[model samples]
Target: MTLYLCFCLAMALFSGPGAILALAPENEVPLHPTTWLGENKVTPVHLPKGRTRRLYFTLKKRADLMSVTVSPCAVPIEWSLAVRTLKDKPPKKPHWSSKKSMPEVWWRGSAREVRIYSYTGNDVDTYTGPVYAPASIYILRLKSNEQNTKVSAYIHEGPGPSGAFPELPSDPKVHILGVGMTSVTLSWSPSSSVVVKDGHHGSLPYHEYCVLVNHKHNYQSLCAAREGIRKERQNVQKRERREKPGKEIVWATLKDWWWQQPDALEDHASSLWDNPEDPGCVCRDVESVCTVSDLLPETQYYFDVFVVDRVNGTNAAYTGTFARTHKEARQAVTSLREGQVKWVTLSGDASSQKGEQLFRFKPRGWQQNGLLTLHTCNGTSKVKVTISSKGQVLSSEEVGHQLAQIWLHGGPSYRLQIQALVQSSSSSSISKGDSNKSKFCLKMQASSAYHRRAAPVFPATLQIKSFNKLRTCNSITIAWMGTEERSLYCVYRRQIPPDAKDIRHSSTDRCLDPEARPANERVLCKYFQELNPRRAVTTAVIGGLDPGVVYVFDVYLMRRWGLPIKYHSKMVRTRNEC
Candidate 1:
């Protein structure tokens, strides 16, 4: 019986109280020599029932306290842990009740047996404040509930290599594949080596690539703008300090003021891709090639590439180079007198006695002349050309196999009609003696011309209060304040033209027929709706729009005698259809 008792005692001592079993072995342990938690020194402490103990450690550099684990002595015990960063001075003994008043507390929870607490920015339960970068002195408070407990505390550090882990690989090679007016395509070779942190190889499979773009040509302007913003912020801060003599400045107040600046610095930089499947910016085929779009034209841009290890919370040095996108090609509108050629085909069957074709031309700028070349379907047939502007004939000519070139001096609007006459033998005419009557078809092509008009007085500006996206896709609600009473307001909406030159030319056409119905359903505009002018606040819901199309809306107030006075214009793009 004594021998059996000795065996039991030996087993108890071997597997029980002083066994040195790791309570939470999976918890991350710091590996860097400089890390405060890397010392591996165990502080054994005894806490009475319902009592708390606080321990302090100072971080010399910026680091992330990833996790905390507790190894209980012999019996399972209920315990709670909390961490707070001491900014100014360490507080007196802090209890669970005073956790909220601490500068920044990370974890607060109770558990039985071994416990491991991990840190996450989104800690919705206890802390509702911004998760700041870990630095300075940290206080770890441990509490025991209804049971006396002896435990060894272990804190984990992140952002450093541990064990035989390797450092981050060298920067990747980035190359500009192509650069367009509004986009830049970049290709890069992936890092050959892995990044090591927390005594383990980085777990994140994807490396983040950041593309930084700056207008090299406008570098001076950008620097000036940045300086101006800095001065403006400084002036505002000085004014606030003067107004509130000794009041403490809060970070939230300054953050709000910084965001309110029209030219915020953050606007200049953008991420290459926010996520793996970002639609706007595409990183295609093994993620080696990234295409960044929605850039400006005729601008010189300098691009820099950065590789980031997000899981390790570290970034590689920027590998930078500069490239300029080709300037946007301007559309050249050659006038008719300058030998601009445009073709309009007028064709008819043999039974038709006459064929006519109407040509409409809207000039770019200033008054000019147009040239018309009439091509006969039959080489032997003679054709008559008649060009008119606003119901007045500008020219008349006749020619045979040789092309009929007619010079026309017309106003902005022109309509040209052509007539063809074919001489026929009596046998072919079905009348034995008729020679002048015959079946013929005519085709005429007219070149474009430039015309000038006097600029008219524009109407009073219409103040648009707000244009907001609706909950439903493909719709936007616009609200505007009216100035003149009893003014009939017409709202015109159209899709934005793809070409810049088309924008200049279409602006005139959009104004001419703001109420014209569109022939194609795909066309969003040529849309017009009249709003009641008696109301002070004018609001309208523009709907039936094609998804992902940019549209421009023009509000015109009708004057006396039905003349539309251009008022307000705005551009908006509809959301993509889900």
Candidate 2:
């Protein structure tokens, strides 16, 4: 997900940046468990008569977890949310096995706020999982964990543009549900809500959902049911006096162009459905326009919806995103500096966005707070390595991808901690980063392709068996059993050749063909076999020749059949006591 900015520089150069313009101020929002405090918001669905909406509230910081408990124990039902394992890259995948790792358990949690839908006697809604990070797509599940209640489920991406305005589904129409006065429900399947992009790009990608409301009246304006399943299209379109607006798709490859002056303005104001469509008489404007109808009137309601975007042309697939909204609007983001490695004591109103987020801390020319972005790859990881003045990582090698250390002229000789505030998975991971690990590099992407899986599945174990040394002279003999979680083990021989000094290149080619014995060494036998999916394979490697020389060797398992990629095992030395 990219950075969501408010308006523009004019908003910041004049009004100022920092906590004042935060959508969710440091004190108003839940503090992030692993990061510093900042802003957050729900998707919008603004209508002309903005009467019904949820109240916007904030927590101390971001919480690693937030539990939802429905009241009135008598109510019975089940609610579950599932995050796709295929979506976010997995953490681990063993090489050579050629199998993708699935999510922790397919789904994460099952539960929702009390307002989603209601339950009658003999029915209890049971939530079965945990909440997820923002912008993450998830499927909702409502089942009879206790039996008796019947309500559809859905996939929510938090909420987005549609949540603030209503529009007709271009293709397959959606079915919505209205719980109580304030609870909005939608039809859903246990399956994934957003259409996943299989591979490359070219096909139009868009997400779709059908919301099943509590009452048909909440969406249908027809005085009566017209047909059995398909409802007649609602007539709310009025002939346009001028040319139609929104004739073109607003292309925004770089987020910087989203709110850029004239470009975004055309799409934001010029685009227009200018009318209502099937089922609901909800009007469509360039921005948004939605409202609540008669359904358990006067009851507090919570509305959520998905915001769809098209990539390619007609045959495009579906991309998922959902958001929720409340009646109260929070302050817009002013200016911010998500780039500082430490609590930059220096300052300025540098730059800020209008309605969303993004606060740039650019310095004119020679200010102490030079402009820089403190980027990170695994915002959830608590590891960091310091970079030296010469650009070398001084701490652990895996702490960071690229590191850069900071130096102070006369300040305390201690490490300064600065949380990303906006990107950390939790405030804790963010805090763990705000350190002096003696040195550190600015956030950078990791280059190790070995760590690309969702869950890192490492080779479970290693087994080595020994053999008796050959009693002959000139060369000693050795043997051992070997096994690996992966395929193709590479055998290496490391021993100085007798004429090595005379050989300018020092011909110690460790990759001596396993089938052929070297002129400088001998091989009894060497070969690799496939490992069992349920278990590893065992093979023996017999050594020959070489009497008084000791040779140390290692086994490198292949993650891929022919790729240079490999994970090695501990060294094994051959005995030369013949």
lDDT for each residue of candidate 2 in 306-331, tens digit (9 for 90 to 100): 22222210011112112232343333
Native-to-model Cα distance after best TM-score fit, residue 123 in candidate 2, in Å: 73
The TM-score between candidate 1 and the true structure equals 0.26
Each candidate: how many clashes?
3, 110
lDDT of 1 by residue, 48-102 (tens): 7775565655444445434344444333444443334334333355455663522
Clashing pairs in 1: 366-451, 366-452, 367-452
- lDDT of the candidates, in the order given: 0.45, 0.29
The estimated TM-scores of all candidates read: 0.26, 0.19
When summed lDDT is taken over every stretch of 10 residues in candidate 1, the lowest stretch is 120-129
